[model samples]
Target: MTPPELDRKSALFLDLDGTLLEIAATPEQVVVPPGLPSLLAHLHHQLEGAVAIVTGRPLAQTDELLRPFSASAAGEHGVSLRYADGTREELPAGIAVPSAWREELEAAVQRWPGVLVEPKPHGFAVHYRLAPEYGNEVWRLVRQLVPPEHPWFHLVPAREAVEIGLRSASKGHAVERLMAHAPFHGRRPIFIGDDFTDEAGMRKARELGGIGLRVAEVFGGDPANVRAWLMEGAQRLDGRSASSIPTGVTP
Candidate 1:
């Protein structure tokens, strides 16, 4: 299906790593292009506050990467959410990981040379991106450390990482919550992402009468192309003719 036009009527939800920005060896090492902040600001204006970054990164990290302009966002796979008006919400305190589990994860990471443990308010993640050879090891450790029948937490295998978080909160839930509010309530939802974790948000977008554009072979599997498409969309929204916009992939 053709994606909804990038206009005021559509609500745009974008993933961060590997979608808006190229994936780096380490999450902290990803580079934000010079003009991306400005471009995103323009798109947010054009969409009338319908633009948001739906990402796995924490809100603080997302803000650090896309500084000078803050859009609505859902972070930590939807464990936290900040609306357009700046109101924030997060998974309840009841869902937090136990201290014992946190210690176990930290100890496990110490055993792996390049593995990193990122602890969130609600859960934790073991990233093996830097040590690809230890991916299976990381997964195995997580499985053994975290009980299979844990009531509140569940394991989410994402790109080069395994995240254990609240079972209830998810990208799909995030999208649903955003769509229930003003500006986004009536608008069609468009989700752009490039990972298995993003599939939830993509499916939610389609359920809301919009399309999900996967960043893969179709768009050259490059985040640069996604950026170009966004820039062109912003330009078109600024009253430029569609014909003046570069063609290839349409967002």
Candidate 2:
């Protein structure tokens, strides 16, 4: 696939799992290439600190995965945030899911040996990738625990998992919040993501006069390809990499 253009005038928002990192069997098994952090850092610097990470993972877990490098980030699908200035948006209390829900999720998954309960700071997820036969049951149970009409919670469906998080937290809102700040306010936004949760952010990017790219449709469903395209774009932006920029093209 042809790499998307990125220049200093672009404000880039990226999704983590399934976009930057391959989705592992378990969340803890995902791997980050040795050069990914540096690649992201270079892009961040080239774009004048306009890059941001928006994901469903918690802020602390994001930090742990991308350690030794930092950028503006939205976590738990925007339930938490860390802006370019190093300050974070304080979350209001009583928004977290009930502890009973977590226990129920954990106990319910026991019926299917391979299904699992993944705990998060503000919420939790039920994964049944290994136990595909139990997918429907897992979904039904989770949906029953956190109903679709719930005032404060939402059930976010993913590749082989479903997440229970705050209804108010969404990637679309995260993009809007990030775009309101310096370095990103006037720049063209390019959001790239891989799942249903990312659709909101993608739509927001397009709505605000920017580009939204889907990994499956645009990059053939491979995070490695996304990384390669990003590297090429960063090189084009920085004018210091091995990538040869088109003589008359504006990137």
For candidate 2, what is the lDDT? Answer: 0.85
Q: Give the TM-score of candidate 2.
A: 0.93
Backbone clash count, each prediction separately: 0, 0
lDDT of each: 0.84, 0.85
- Global CA lDDT computed for model 1: 0.84
Best by TM-score: 2
Which regions of candidate 2 fall more than 4 Å away from where they truly are? 1-3, 90-93, 243-251
Q: If scored against the real structure, what TM-score would every candidate get?
A: 0.91, 0.93
Q: What TM-score would you give candidate 1 relative to the actual structure? A: 0.91
